[model samples]
Target chain A: MNIPLLSLKSILSRPLSTLLSWLLMSFGVTIVVLILLVSAQLKNEISKNAQGIDLVVGAKGSPLQLILCNIFHVDFPTGNISLKEANNLSRNRYIESAIPMSLGDSYRGYRIVGTTKAYGDLYGAEIQSGQWFEEDMKAVVGANVANLLGLNLGSQFQSQHGMSEEGEEHEEQSIIVAGILAPSSTILDDLILVSIPSIWNVHEHEEEPGEHEGEIIDLPKLGIAVSQEQLEEEEITSILIKYRSPMAAVMLPRMVNEVGNFQAASPAYETARLFNIIGVGVDVVNIIGILIVVISAISVFIALLHSLKDRKYDIAIMRSMGATRRQIFVHVLMEGLLIAILGCISGLVLAHAAIGILAFYLEKLNLSWSFFVNDEVWVLTGGLIIGMLAAIIPAGLAYKTDISKTLSKA
Target chain B: MIQIAGLSHCFSDNVVISYPDWQVADGEHSLILGASGSGKTTLLHLMSGLLKPTNGSVIFDTQEINQLSPSRMDKFRGAHVGLIFQKPHLIAALTVKENIKLSTFLGKKPEHNRHIEEMLDSLGLIELAHRKVHQLSQGQAQRVAIARALINHPKFVFGDEPTASLDDESCMKVVELLKRQSDQHGATLVIATHDQRVKNHFSNKLEL
Candidate 1:
């Protein structure tokens, strides 16, 4: 006579109500859990790629868009800036090291970056093949680029004129894959690295010193004056700056933005702003999840209350068979708890299943998604609390049931 | 053996039942006869410790049932008493054998299938032991309820309108079965009902 087993059997005897309650409970849990999963993955990917660089100096535009474009590589560059002005700013006493990156052409949607060897050092990217790009037109492909594009050492590929795959290809210069970097499991694993001259000669990622977006009116003649050689030393897409100390964080972005046509964006500040925007959407989802849980609790409460009426005679019979009021109370509570636990399990599986689908899309970007994070544990705790809370009043009713009255009624 | 003294029960100042004192020796079988609302069921609840009398004491053997706490009373009842209601309230999801074994389970006694098998065989419900309670006919389900009551081999058995809804033949068979089973186990039996057909089955009868 396992009393709990008997209670569970009683619950199972009414399959429709149990299933309805369980499904509702899982719906609440699944929404909360899926939100946690997606947010956790996004945070991890953002912070991992945003580390090391404190501020990004780029063509004047939206600061968040600048960080999104240069630091995270998720958007396009905001035109271009003079390399001379960016370098002079990099020489500030508060600056630790500045790495210049120019992005324009791509190979099959993977951005081909032209930067110094210091850029590789910033991400700790190790060369797994011949060597890092040593000369113009010599390129080092990241592991994902190598795997996805099947680029091997000595393989040569033509670059497209812009960030997108549909952008016209620069067929004149076929850049050779001088090296392939090992997988760093970061945004670095999705890029193609080459010398700065390679990007200029290929698609002219530069612009006149004061030209921001107005050059679009003279697109056909934009690259005529800056010879291939002059373009190399004249412009770069953006300069990634790291502060020597925390105090520099307060003054550097302010000074850089005040001085040049380039706007400075802190990855930390911008990413947080991005998440704040994303947070609003997530807050709405959280409310919906909580509403689902609240409705399910009401459902459980009503279901249990009705079942109590239905089981009054049965409860009286159990009392006659030696069950205490406390036993009966625990029996009812256990029924609610069982439904909650089942919901938690099903919701977790559902959350991970949704994440599994997200992972397929993220994989193309060389990003990783994982489950079983701290957020999931919090969601599990939430589920149990809801279950226990839902059962309280119903269990109390069972506790106060008058056995004799119920038997006589039957 | 059971003894009741100075028994009275009230319902919110609306109705009160003042029961006549009665004493029954061990192994005795008795019937409580009454009209509707005559308090036959109330007296039985008091005797079985299911209800606390407004002003009275019930002594079953050496235990003061009314004086015991609810938990202790439940334990005492599971070990020493059995009850059958007007309708069989056996859990519909469980099999006949599982329903009967619930008595031993609630008593916290290590389950013994032998006791269940004996009760089923004696009640001629062995063939239906594995069937869900919902599949049983009214008489068969009633017999299973009886088997559950006897699984603990209780010293006392109480029934409230156990055969009120049955036909004449089925009612007699149920009474005879209860009588024969109680005789074989040397247990006392008390039944409260409004059914006139069950009147002749008990020689020791209380009429209200």
Candidate 2:
């Protein structure tokens, strides 16, 4: 009872140690929190986009990568699956909707995705300016790209042929910015979208006035438009398939692998894989947290134990005044608990600050995911428990103190 | 009222004390007199229930104070006993008034009720009551300690070498203050000290 106030004052008295303990504890918790926050947000974004659309049918590489590159503008595609094959598959009774993508180009480091208008409405994207491209050479840019590049409707921009901004051009095909999308808190935030034929037209144009003139250049084929008559005429990278029922989930990956060059990956499986990848980082942080808690406990124990020596006269005075050993024990234990509680609160505040910084960076880089997820309470509770554990060993020492030996020495 | 029977103690192999018995009636003023290492502090520790006697019982009222659980003894001590140290040992973080208030708070006693100023007025500490413990001088800190002890109006008062560091004048003032306050409340007063200067003041004494 009396321990609460006394412990609070004692902790306040040693501001430096309390602050250090708080930082150390929060640092560990922050990493764990960041991992949890980002992963959950990523999962939410995936699941949200994946809703209604049941399965992904793609060229047989990494299904997760295909999803990331196609559905989400976060990575480069392995390649594209045939459009004719995709169209044929769309006619299946189980297939509800189908959209195709032609990739490989960037406008100022933002991906130039050559896809349909369904890409926008599927992810619930809104065009703030102009309209979705219906013509071959028109483009629709994400809100972040529009703002960052200061581009507006009808502005003509050229796309580079690779991931980098400085990637070489295959031809000077000017694209009109037909639309700009609103922020959808998804992969749609960092893209320069255009009609799929725009990608085909850009690559199909004759090479410009270069020294290698009159050379008939071949297009570095990424994916083919699948035609039943000439199925082997072109190469294709990957495809995204949507199924009507759980039957596709069970049978599609098996069938797609048996048939296509690309791999069929479920985002769910890949997300779990991502979790396993990050779980090691969490484990390291947890070990550091446990160590800091133990060290903090030791710090408290040593501080109290050393104080007990200097406080002999003080203890003698209290004892003389009629404080029992139990009272003194409670007094000391309260001090430790108070310090732990203070450290925990400070750590939680610190973790949130770190989260803010991380969120800002993610936004700046136009990263599709966020580190501020919904499960904040878990991190806060975890920090408090660690702080409480740190106080236990020191408080226990106070309980075993022998008053007679202590006072006699004085 | 207080009573002790066949109390004995040792420190890891060294026999520090082996007293037969001791008794103090209500309202008695006694000095536990002894040389250095003669177990005067040990005797005070037993009386306060800070240490249990290896053998013997210390009875205060109808209960064996020595037999009480540690927490129970603490509650009893916080509520009914007042202690004064030679060094004053006030918590350095608190102001003089706050230090006294702390004791009352711990004891669960009624608020000192702005009578903290009145108490400080008696001890000539009113002007300095708002100052922190570390800000006070030797004599001022000792006066603050006295105000703190008396704030709870405890039934028994114990002084462990209360005036050991004070000059003749400050010591006399402190002793007179202690006797006046103890007599005013009809409380039992126990002083454990090697200082002989306090001998002429009390009517009753316990020499070890």
* Model 1 C-alpha lDDT per residue in residues B52-120, reported as the tens digit of each score: 989888999888799998889999998989888788889776899899878788877667888789889
Q: Score the docking of each candidate (DockQ).
A: 0.78, 0.45
Query: Candidate 1 chain B, which ten residues in sequence have the lowest lDDT sum?
Result: B107-116
Model 1 chain A lowest lDDT segment of ten: A215-224
Off by over 4 Å in 1: A204-233, A364-369
**Best model per TM-score:** 1
Model 1 lDDT, full chain set: 0.83
lDDT of 1 by residue, A1-410 (tens): 57678878877988999898889889898899888877877787788888899888889988888899887788888878986566567778888878788887788999988887878887888998889876778998889999988999999989987888898987777899999999997888899988876777675445432233322221111111234335335688888888899999888878988876879999998899999999999999989997887787788888898988778778888888898888888999998888888988998888788778777876744323355688788778888888888998999988888888888777
Clashing pairs in 1: A1-B105
User: What's the true lDDT of residue A36 in model 1?
Assistant: 80
